[model samples]
Target: MLNIRCPYCEEDRPEIEFRNAGEAHIARPDEPDRVDDRQWADFLYTRDNPKGWHAERWRHVHGCGRFFNAVRHSVDDRILLTYKAGEPKPDIERMLREREA
Candidate 1:
């Protein structure tokens, strides 16, 4: 079972209590109506599907009912860390390299 920490709740909870909301940090078009159809479609439907470490958004649906950011290792399904929506992303890869050095 996976344990996810909710930044808002400040505690770890079972994965069942949360819902993976897919890739995070996507930027919205400044002028949506002016964008080409293909661009608009891409924004709405396209998302990162990486094989390695990835950053994603998750909703604590059964708990705080708030959304948070989480960096997870895709291959192992291991969550590296979680943080508030507006908080800066942590450099987990750099930290890992440092640890291995």
Candidate 2:
């Protein structure tokens, strides 16, 4: 089973304890009423399906019950890192470079 690290709990737990919450870093419209139907639809439905490293939101349901962000490799389904919810997305390119060093 996949192991996911919870940023809040500071421990690695089984994937069964967590729930994938979908793509992270999605920004809601500043004024929902002002947004057109098409814009609203795009915001609600559109998401990146990248083949490589992707940032996603995950909830530690069975553990801390806190939501966190994680960078996972889509091809291998390996979680590279986890961070708190409001933290800025990490630079994946830099991280890969550092890993190679």
Question: Tens digits of per-residue lDDT for model 1 on 1-101?
Answer: 89999999999999999999988888789999999999999999999899988999999999989999999989998888899997777787896788699
Tens digits of lDDT, candidate 2, 12-101: 999999999999999999999999999999999999999999999999998899999999999999888999999999999999999999
Give the lowest summed-lDDT range of ten residues in model 1.
Answer: 86-95
Model 1 misplaced stretches (Cα beyond 4 Å): none
Error of 2 at 74 (Å): 0.8
Residue 28 error, candidate 2, Å: 0.6
> TM-score of every model?
0.89, 0.96
| TM-score for candidate 2, residues paired by index | 0.96
Residue runs of model 2 more than 4 Å from their true location after superposition: none
